[model samples]
Structure formats: C-alpha cells, structure tokens
Target: MSSLAYGSFCATCCNLIPPETEPLACSTCAKPCCWKCAREPAESVSLFNAPAVICVACDAAMDLRGGGKMVPKPPMEQGLQRCRMHPERFLNLFCLTCQVQICCDCFVVQQDHKRHTIDSIEEVYRQKLLETVEKFREIPKRLKLVDWEAVRQVEENLKIIQEMETRILGDIRQLFQQRTAIMLNKTAEKKAVLQKTKDFVDRTEMQHRQTLESIQGLNTNDFLRLQAALNERCESILKDVGQLQVEPVRWDDIDCDLLPSCKLQPISLNLPNGDAAKEKHVQIQLIDDCGIVWTTTFFIGGQSLALEMKPNRQLDEFHFKAIVEMSHSSQIKVSGKSFSFKGFLAKNELISLPKLNSGGYLTDTGDLVMRLGIRPENILEESDLLKALLVQQRKLNSQLKVENATLKDQNFILRGDMLRVSSESQQNKETLETQVVALTRRLKMFQHNSYVHNQTLQVRPQTPISPVSQPEDDKEKLSSDMQMLRTKLDEMKTSMKAMNPFAIGSFEIYRWSKDSKFYSPQVASHVGVTIYIIVQPNFACEKSSDVNAYVCWAKGPKLRCQIFIEVVNEFEDECVREDRVFDFSKGTSFTWKSVISHYNLFRSDGFLSDDHLKIKFGVRPAVE
Candidate 1:
C-alpha cells in the first residue's frame, strides 16, 4: 500500500490485468505487480500460514537462510540467476499460470503476465518429488516376484513338452508295428498260395507220367479212363488257381483318425482400434494363452497391406472358431464371420473387421473405437436347450416303443382266445349237424315202417318230433358272437400298428444354389436340432472318378444313430443309397466317398430336377 499502480503486469504470464482486478505490489521492493503473481499469498500452500508474500529477490534471500533437507540446484535456479527480461533481478518464483520462472520486473512491467498465477518453485518441486518416491517404493519388490513366476512357468512348459515328445514317439512306433504286421500277413498268405500251387503241379505231373507208363502195359479202355480222369482233375484245379486273382488296394483301411487334430487352446481378445478410424494402419499383439511368453502379431499397417497374424516361431499356431462382435455406441451385434476349423488356425491368416450397422461409431473424443470379441470354435459342444429337447423326445420314443410291445403282447393273447372260441363253435356246429342228420334218417325209416304197418293195420302212426331246433339256434348265436369278437380284435390290431412309429424323425435336403460350393445355410426344424449342408459340387474330376460327401456334428448326449442318405430320382425311387450304423458318441465326422457317379447326380432327367439335387436323409435310433 506504500505505492499503488493503476495497472501492472503479472510476473507469471506478463499479461495486463485491468484496474478492476486490483493488482498487488511486491513485499520487499514495493514494485507494483498483479495479485496473480502472488499466487493468493495470504492462503496456505498446505493448510498452514504462509510466511509472507514477496518478489523473486526476497524468495532467493529466504532460500539462503536455515533450510534443511537440501536438494540439487537446477541450472535455471543456481547462484541467483537473473531473469531473461530483467538482468538485475533473480528467478526464484515459478509462474503457476504460465509454467515458467519470472523476476519482479516481469511482474511489474509485462502485460501478458499481469493476470497469471505464481508460486515458490522450491515448494512445488519438493511436494512432487515426495509423492513420486512414495508411489514407486515397492515396484522393485513386485517386479522381482514377477520374474520368479516367469521362471516357474518355463519349467512347467519344459516338463509338458518332454511328456508330449515321449508319447508321440511311442505312437509313431506303434504305427510302424501295425503296418509291419499287415505287410507280413499279406506276404505270408501269398507264399502259402504259391507253395500250394507248386505242390499241385508236381503231383499232377507225377500222376500223368505214372498213368502213361501203366497204360503201355494195360488195355486201351483203362488208358482212356486214366487220361479222362487226369483231364477233369487238371481243369478243376486250374479253375481254382485262376480264381485267386490279385487283390485290389483297400484305401478304406487307411485310418485317417489315428492322430487327433490339435489340443484345445482357448483365448479371448478385445480389439479396440480395429476399424482404424483415425489411421488405416494398425497393429495388435496376440498373447499366448498357454503362458509361453510368446506372442503373434496381427498388423494392418505394414507393407503387407492386409490384416494378418504372423507368428515368429515355427511351432506357433492360432485357431479362429471365433465369435466376432462389433460395437457402435451402445449396440452390439454379431459380425457373421464365425468359422469352423478342422484344426488350429495357422500362418498367413487374414482378419476382417466387424462391420458397423448404424450411426457414427466415434466417441465424444473423436475415437472410432471398435470392440472385437473372440472365441475358438469347438465341435464337441451341444446346445443346452436343444439337448434337453432331444432327451425328452427320446424318452417319448422309448415310451412309444414300450407301448408297441405291450400292444403286440395283447394281440398275441387275443389271437389265442379267438382260436379257442372258434374251436368251441366248430364243435357245437358239428354236434347240431349230427343231431339233425340222425333225426331225418329216423323219420325216413319210420315213414317206411308206417307204410308197411298201414298195409297191415290200415292206419298211419304219429312220428315223434325231431329235437334239432335248439341246437341249431345255439350254433347261430355262437357264430354271431365269434364274428363280433373277431371284428373288435381286428380294430385293436389296426390301432396298434398305427401307433408304432418306425423312426423318431426325418428331414429332406433338396437344394439348388448357383454357388453350391459355399452356399451352406442352416436348416432348423422342430426336430430340436439344426442341419447345415456344406457342399462340394465337383462335376469335373480327372484324377478320381466319383463324388464324396462329409458331414460334421457338434457333440451332444451320445446316441447310436442309424443314418441313411439316399439320392432320390425324380420318380421318387432311390437311385443310390448309403446306409450305415453311425456311432454319434464321438465328436467327429463321418464320410462316404464314391457313393454315386458325379455325372448321374447333376445331369438332366437323372437325380437333378430343375438343376437341383434331391437328397432324402433319415436318422433313427440304431437297433440294439
């Protein structure tokens, strides 16, 4: 208050503060300065009373006083260094607003620093250093622990690899043994046949020579009989030898399922910058899920100019049975890029971005962030709801089978009862016929006698009434009752036949696609499952002469399925059919090759109708 200025520069920013802001003066030199340069000097830096509000020269003097806990002098603050604009004054105060050190003249004269805030540079540096040291004190200890963990993981891997190597070598040796056994069997069988043939030839020659010698001393009839016998025996033996032709190669015996595809290694990755909103070039690291300190790099940036994952090591591999999702704003949807790999995804694989469906994906900060969700595909999984449905259906089918068995048992019982009733009716009818015949014969006799009597006595005697009416009535009623019972039994048998189902369910696949190779859409029905027809339509085959079909099923509650795939002609008759009892317990696929000629399947008026192939597929529980 000793001297007042209308306006003054701030020592910090050198900006002019207008008269209304009310600038303050330095405590020592009485130099007019903005209040901003004082840094609200009346308040405490750490909830305590500040000593005083002074200029850079006063702060430097105070630093030289008794201050313990000394620190290294920075070049800018050493030896009372003068400010750039003011040569006489020292630079000890830090402009908090402008982030630079300034002297008293800069605060009193400069217009830009007029409204800036300033604080003691020493206090700010001291507080920041203490916080930094405290935060990083235990980082070294944690890092040492991490190093130990890495060592343990490497050891585990080494042990696993050793076990794997031994097992694999054993498998290879076993394969060689099996092959050797098969070769030995084939060679032994051929040697046996050759030895038998040589013995037969030698015996025949000896016999013929003996017969010739014997024939010279015998009759012509005996010689003729011996030669004829030799001719017939030689012809029959030669025919038997000719029947043993060379065996064709059996390719079906080649077991492709000997080695498993790969061990299941599941990994989940989130891609935040896949879309390349700001830069088209991007790269991401794929960490190994097996704790192998290994990583594959997927780069969209480099000269390769494609999104691909490259593994550094020869043993590195990846699999993509991935469920990819794209997120824009709050909406998330599947990218429709799920794939099924027979094995792990390997080298030179390209990745595609999840397409955005709606509005701009950029956030408030102009980052078009994309999120990717990844999951490996597994064929050994079943839908839980569908599995439950299948179980219910199976129970129902089993119940129906039980009911059918019960009906058959009842039918057999009814057949016995009907036989007994028919036999009784036959007996009754026979008895009635006998009675009627007897009565008629007796009456005829009586009539003859009566005529004789009439000649003698000249009067006709009364004939006793024949007793056949009751027996005849009983026979008619019994026959009517038997017919009614037979009708009822017939009705029951018809109902039982109708209730007995031959199969659990069936589906038909009749499809025609211009791009049949990759056009496999899912077909779902109330059968509580789905079917996907992935086709390989190759009409032109120069090397192999027929067609092949393969079907894969994700695992579920194990079942013994009898599956039949038939190629149906336009007339609804089976052109060809493949029937097999497939054990669906394993999570693997079944294949049928060379089932039908390729030409017959796709040609006009054959199996194809309107350029479409019709297949009737059926599945039933295999008979135990």
Candidate 2:
C-alpha cells in the first residue's frame, strides 16, 4: 500500500497474507487480499454482507462467459437471484412477456423480453403472494360446514381411508417439522393461534396435505401474513363449535371422497445376489443444449445423498437431503430439492438400455426396464425454424455466388503472375546449376593450387619455415570449406527447382488428377534457421509409391552444424531419418539434403486438405 492509503486500506486488499490479519484470498489467483480491495463489483448478499473474493486484476481480465479456462464463478446472491439469460446480471426485474422473473439485462439487453408489462421483482412477488393468500382463504371458509352424514355412509371406505391416514399423517408430521423450523421466529401469540387453527383440519385428506406441503415453501413474509390472517379467522369462529352446520349424505361427491385412489408404498432396494452389501452412489445428469449441467443425485444403503444446490462451484453450497420415492407402479424417482412431495410419477420415461425384456417393470432375465430420454420441453426449438433456415440458406447461396465471381477475377490476375514466375524460375534454375559447376571447379583448382604451392616451398629449401610459429594453412582450409558449402547450397536449390514447375514461392492450384509434389510450411530449426520439406513421389530410392520427402534449409545464413532430422509416417512411427555426420571439420565433405521416405500424405484425408494442406512440424535445434 502507498503511504497515502496505508492506514485506511484494508489488510485484505493486497496479495500475501500478513500476520496482522486473517488470510482472505482471491478466488482466481488464490492470493491473499483485503476484502475491500479484492471485492467484486456485484453487491454482496451474504448474511453479514461479506464481499466476494476476487482480485481487481482477475475481475477485469477474466472472461468466464467467453470460454476461458479455470473460470472463477460469481457468488450466489441471497434475496436477489441471478438471471438464467445473463449470468452476470441479477433478476431484479419481471418479464411480462413470459410472466417470469428476469434480470435487468434481460429486459434492457435482450430484445425478446423488452416490450411488456415490466415491474420490479418485489412487486411481482407481492402480487403472487396475495393471489396465493386469496386461494388459501378458500380452505377455512368451507371448513365451517361439514357433511358428516356423507362421510359416515361409506363405513368400508372410512376404514380404508383410516388405514391410509397413518402413513399420510407421518408424511405431514415431517413436512410440518420443516415448517416449524422456518416459523420459529414468529410471535408466540400468533403461533398459538396458528396451532389452534391447524387443529380444526389437521386430519386433512392426502390431496389437501399435498397442497399444504407445496404452500409450506412460501416466502417468510407471505407465510407470516397468511398465518396472521388465519389467526384472525380462527379467533372469530373457534369460540363456538356447536354453531357449525352438518350437511346430508352424498357418497359420489368429490369433496366428500377424502381418500386418494393412488396407492402409496415404500421404495424397496433390490440388490443382486452376492452383491447385497454394495452401496450405490448414483447421480443423474441433465445437460441442456447450452452445455449447462443440472444433476439430481442420491445414494442407497448406509447413507443418503447430500446434494448441495449451490449456484456455482465457488461459493458455499446449500446442502439438501435427497429422497428416493417409488412414486408410481413403474419407474423409481429421485428428488434433490428441499421439499419432498408425496412423490411425482415418471410417466413414459424411457431409460436408454440396449434392450428391455418383455415383462413387467423388472424382467425375469434381469434386464430391467430402465431408460433415460430427453423431454420435449428440454429441447430448444425455434418457433419459426423452417422460415429461419430458408432465409439462412438463401443468404448462404448469395454469398457463394459472390465468392465464385471474385475467385474468377483473381484467377485472371494469377494467370499473368504465374507466367512471369515460370520464366523467372527457369532462369533462376539455370543460374543455380551454373553456380554449382563453377563452385566445384574452384574447389578442384584450390586443391591443385595448394599442392603446387607445397611443391614450390619444398623446392626452395632456402625459404624459412615461417618464423617458427603457424602456417597460412588455416585460412586456405577455411576458404575451401566456404566454397564447398556454397556448391552444396546451389546444388540443393537446383534440385528443388527441378521438382517444381510452379516456382519456389507458394501458389494454390486445383486438379482432378493426382498430385506428385507437396511443400510443407516453413518451420524453424533448433538453430533458428527456417526449414521446410519438399516432397516428391519416390519410384526408385525407396521402391515405394508413397513419397521421398527432403528436409532442407530455407532463406537463412548457412551455418556449419550437423542436425539429426527424423520424419514420421501418418501413424506417427519413425519411418525414416537422416542422422549422418557432416565432416565440416575436414573441409572436404558435407551434405544438404535430409531425405526420408513415407506414406502418401498427398491423399485428401491425410495432410492434404481440399484446397489447403496442413502439416504440423516440430522444431529441433541443430546439434554440432
């Protein structure tokens, strides 16, 4: 910290955990920083308003949405939830177009939900709460009158209903346990009245119990308001039970039938023989088209799956206990949400096994009828898909036509350039050959000169043996080496030009006939000299129809060094190599071409693309 901001700055504001404060680290770098400096721009909805850990540099440089790796996720907000459409933005606004809560970006940035009856999230929440409360008032209003004669007429039905009552009561008891935990903060006076009101209709039918369980998850404010209103009604009417009305018998009446037709059963864990002790930890994954994965997981035997419904991987996860439910006659289901319903039946849910034996839910052949299939709603389909596709097809056709015309014009221009290059290539080829011959002649001449000079020195015995130090041998030997390299370089250039009629530079051509020559992109050698391969059909050297590729230096200073070049085939096996030693020290011998034989890479499926050939090359330093 600078002197100006030292004392005022938080200890968590920088990288490094000082002994003076607790270690708070950035989510991205894992470096310790003060909360004040490292805090993210989004407002914190943490219990204590604790800021999210993210160094300023990472927050600015990170591109989580653009497919960057090691992405640090944003912390989940408490009251204000995030928008599915835009992960960075919060759902503070309502989207009237879809009658759903949406982030500010959804209304302002996304054009689809722009024009509609927009309102604040709080406003929508309150409106929905009131609507729910109005529906809730229906239960108590009807509870005032009971048709006792209708209920008593079906004594047999009453016995069956009473049997189901015990299990239903147990489920309701557990549901209220969760509810009580939520309602503990309310006033004792209101809670006492709520208890008295609950007692009047505590033994409700299964359907009503389901409705109550669903309502138990309402917001705290809405629940409190609902409870307060219920308390008011109970105080007004519970004073005299004798005033309640009793109606006549009507056995067929839907409201009088207090029993659910659907049978409720406990889930049985069926284990294979000799594997009865095995505990299964299963997670069912639901991946959307956008690549987001939602998993509902559970465990069997010794433990229950503790699935945490966290917004992302970074923050603290809100753990929930998973429940297994038989639900229906067929498929077994699992729900990871906090609220456990009477259970939902998985109708027409097919589990993707190769085959299912023709039997009941579980076949005798042990081929269970387990299938997982995508639901229709999960798939994203455009409403006007056909029209959109047709429009896109038309645009693509027009683009192709324009490209074809442009290519034709370019072909004319290229034809002229090709003719000019051909002429230069021929001239250049001849010049290189001439230079090679001249170099070879000079090398021979230098040998003759050296021999003649030695003979002259021998004949002149009077001539001193050079002041007792070194001879002029080193310089003469170096000159011969220089000429030798130049000769080899010229020879190599001639050979390359002989293999191609289209000049040394790059040129694209289309041919229905098979091609015999290919050039790889120039790659740098370990010595920094650019190296490239010139491939030609080998009919004699390797007795193969594939190829004889030669690696050669390209457009660089000729340095004296021996390099080991290994070439591999399509399967990446070392097919050939040029590891021969170059006697540059002898100043008499050297090699330029590093040739190897391999499979036909000119095939379209191999390295040769339709109009472009892509060959990956690895660079190795020249070893002296």
Winning model by lDDT: 1
lDDT of 1 by residue, 1-624 (tens): 222333445543466657566554443443445545545443333354443343553442111121222333334245446777767556655678887777656776778778788665555566678899877986887888998999999999999999999999999888878877876787688678767767877876786677557767777787676787767866876676566443322222333334212222232333345345323445554443222222333433322222333333332233334322323443332222333442333334333333221344334553433332233333223233235446767999999999999999999999999989868755764554455455455556555654554465334343458545444454465555545545554554444334322232223335433324532343322122222333455645322213344343433346665555465666656466776665555444533323333534545446655455554444544432
Q: Return the lDDT, model 2, position 70.
A: 28
Model 2: per-residue Cα lDDT at residue 148? 57
Per-prediction TM-score:
0.26, 0.21
User: What is the lDDT for 4 in model 1?
Assistant: 33
Mind sharing the TM-score for model 1? 0.26
Question: Which is the leading candidate under TM-score?
Answer: 1
Stretches > 4 Å off in candidate 2? 1-270, 273-297, 302-325, 330-515, 521-535, 538-624
